[model samples]
Target: MDCREAREKLLLATSDDLPSAEASELRSHLTSCAACRGEEARLADVFGRLATMKRDRMPESVRAGYWEGLSARLREEGLVRSPGGARSVARPARGISARLAGATVAAAVLVGAFLVGWFAGLFTQQEKGTEPPRAVRPDTPPPAPRADEGREREPIESAPATGWTSDFALGNGPADRGEGVYAEFVLGPEAAGENPVEYGIDEALPQDPWVASIDF
Candidate 1:
């Protein structure tokens, strides 16, 4: 396999989860590829160091108290017995077990509460719409063309003009008959060809223009 493929498989190999055949193939590739082998070694070293780091240990006092509490609870619950036919008082060993169980349950409850609160906070923030600004990658592809592509460009036969006409003021002065204003107008056939129209001035329009009014 190539270096890229071999490097990807190296993780499975290090974890000893790679199938025998795949592992064998990767191993063979690694033997021949120094760069891939070096990368594998570096990853193995990092994981080994992480694994060797000491985990958080329960304090001796905390452990002792836990056991003591557990024993008392067990005795109260009638789970442990005393010697000499008399119901034995809660012992250290019993207390230790009980305390450990209690601590475990408490920890689980705390974790569950924390997770619930965190998710709730996240949802609340989402409802408020405080979203992190996305970094638009330069290489992202544009949206796909719509299914009705080129449909708008199809031509429609124009109807013959009717006799009805009306005059309207064009700005404050007489219209510049031959100035050649590149106006874009949408005329509905039912409006006697006097549809909503937009006139572009000599200057370019702003990026975000205000809408004054729209008539149906």
Candidate 2:
């Protein structure tokens, strides 16, 4: 047998479970291969040491009591396989349930603490009232005007009556009447005729009777 096959059979051999043919093959390989023999010897020594160290030498009475207790426990847990199996029951795994329970409790506590801290942070942020800062844009050139630039405004023929007006001769002046036509009218002594009227007369009838006038 090759070294790999021999090593596999060697493990089964240590368990006293190797078939007779395989056992013989492994023994034959060990006789010719010094390296395989040395490996087997090392494994055997390690297994022997472990076996010697791990087992606690118990008195016959104590051993019997332990077996009885294990059998009763197995019966209670509904794990007793057969009537004869109780005498040679496997040892219960060491502290597995206690370890698992402790780990579960620790994990729960850690999760609860993390959740509390997370919510506390949220509450703190709410209390402080944090808001994202407004973004500042970089300076850029002003936009150009649309193509239909000066066409928006239609020129007014005259100033608004209630606002202000400008005569052809006078530059810019306030309107005489609050609401009146913005046409030019002759207003000198000659234009007023022989019975000339002053500018601020309250009842100054126009010399031209048909001309449009204001009451005030």
Candidate 3:
């Protein structure tokens, strides 16, 4: 008998319904097949636990529908052989348990793959963390200058000092203003000397239209 036939005969094996010849065949197949042996062991363990559970907890219609559907599948799959009778009776067992075990195995595989990927990511991050940073050399060239940096800046002359000087010294009152386009003069302290130089309006406003020209 194959594993499928042996598993179908499993419940019958526990009961008196299984014929001796079929039992011998099942036993021989179990020795060779690790999967069938595991399933047989699982059934025995599960069936014992199931015995105490209430079977009538579901509504009558629901229970009937479930059993009817399962019965059709078993008959269609030839998982259970019906004896010669007007009505099909005595189905082997629920194959749902075997399907559930397969589903469980698939779930475990997905979880195993997920955990492996997660740990691999962590290991990769740790490897990156352990690596030392590269050092910058002191002689490395600086970043290129900006386009505007090469242009010359406009020169700004410093404002004249507040204090007076010997040459071109500012008078006490805000330097006098004239009606014409007059010159305003101020000198720094560095220009102080005995020979005081006078700064006239013409020297400061030589190009002004109103500047008074002097003739020698």
Candidate 4:
């Protein structure tokens, strides 16, 4: 074998894990090559030290307990994937729904209370910008209408009526009219006599001229 092949086998041979064929080839190369022999010796020394050295190890009891705890934990996690196992977990969802319902009820009550209070205030308060109507009092039966109150009172007739009277009643009668059903002459006897008492030019005037002159 070449030095490279010899070196590869030598590494496996140091741990005594080389196949018999490779070992025989490595031995043949070592016999012929000084370099291969030196490498073999160095590798053998390292593995010898590794094999002989003592190391700290866990006790069988500790190892078994650790494995048991790990297995138990894994089993629990696997079981949690099942529906029945999922039910075992605590849920905040139901509690949240209950709280929401309670909150809604509380809100409704608050609204109702506010409305009632508002309506009560409206009804109890007096109206704005206008006066409240006066309350009607119960009628008292008008002093039982006295016995004499219903009778028609007789009014004494006035001689001259209250408002307006005819012109005859005011002493203004027609020229030919008489008073009190009797024909009384309203005109006086002729003012001038046949003989003149006090002579004036009006006495010389005829009756027709006098009438005409007085008119004109």
Candidate 5:
């Protein structure tokens, strides 16, 4: 047998997996090849040392601590009840952080909607070729009046003096003639702080007379 075959059988023999017939062939090859004999001796020494070494075991307190921590975590999560209590109280469906996050998202949405509406209105105005109304400032001056505004108004005229006359019940004009109708006239005060008591009449009527004299 070759040294390669002998080495394979040597590893199996160390684990007690090789058959008796293969073990005999491996031993004959090791005796003939010096290198195979040294390799078999090295494997025997490694296996012997491993077999003599002691195995370590996990501590009881470590397992107990792990189970206690898991039970505490389950209790905090409301998945398990306390050992002292007969029943468990359910936690709120929404936590403080969840409610706060909802409020923040709502506020952000409102602000975003307001901004979008404002921008849309601005863009629409621009598309329509219309300008937005500007705010009136306190310092801005009022519009000036037109130049012909004053001249457009007409002057008020006084009433005619004949409008104050009243017809008389006696003779039409004078005692000498009874053809024309007699009329009374009203006059204003000639000076300040003086009562107007002067009276006059005309004997002959004219078409348009400025003055006339008569006796009562």
Candidate 6:
């Protein structure tokens, strides 16, 4: 026999009303099925404990209306009366209350988890701490120009050779170096081989030979 049938038989056996043939079959099934045997042991344990509990006697006044009130309540709940007026079939609530209770517990758990995660994140950020603001140094002025820095760098000194003597000098005047500089060019009799010819500072020379002005 299956465990379902065997368990029903075990319940009936508690009242000593199980038939001899069914008892024999159940005993045989229990011998082969360890699960059913364990269920039978549990049932026996529960019944043994219940048997030892003190039984309270019902008063006659309460007992008289108890059955009538129970029957009326059962009828109001749409329960079907069974045989012998001692049994009934109640309409199950289909676990509606249990499902609602389970949903409430699930929502509570989700809220608790979210709170825990938020607190954890907050604590982690606090532990890492914020970086201090960097100290900003003030902008510094560049160093002053050196005394020898304003000398003119002449590029004409590295030019191709010309058969002329050129002398360029700056005067010790009120202006800065290269501001009041002067240049003197001594002309030559030949284009290439002749010696340079000198002219007096006060002489008015001819202007037709070569004249070019250069700005420093």
- Give the number of the best model, judged by TM-score: 6
For all predicted structures, in order, the TM-scores are: 0.26, 0.26, 0.26, 0.25, 0.25, 0.29
lDDT for model 4, on a 0 to 1 scale? 0.30
lDDT tens digits, residues 1-216, model 4? 765456546645765678998888788878877755765665454444332222222233322333233234334544222234532222223333233332222212222122222222322232232222322324322323333343221111121322211100001111132211100001011123321011111111111111112110
Task: List residue ranges in candidate 4 displaced over 4 A.
Answer: 54-216
lDDT of each: 0.34, 0.33, 0.34, 0.30, 0.34, 0.34
Q: TM-score of predicted model 2? A: 0.26
Superposed Cα RMSD, model 5: 62.3
Task: Assess the local accuracy of residue 9 in candidate 5 as a C-alpha lDDT between 0 and 100.
Answer: 63
Whole-model alpha-carbon lDDT for candidate 2: 0.33
lDDT of model 1, residue 188: 19
Model 3 TM-score, 2 decimals? 0.26
Off by over 4 Å in 6: 12-24, 31-35, 81-216
**lDDT for 211 (candidate 1):** 8
Clashing residue pairs in candidate 6 are: none
Model 3 residue pairs with clashes:
none
Clash totals for all models, in order?
8, 0, 0, 0, 0, 0
lDDT of 5 by residue, 32-86 (tens): 7776565566556544533332222223322234335434544665544687664
Candidate 1 residue runs with Cα over 4 Å from true position: 56-216
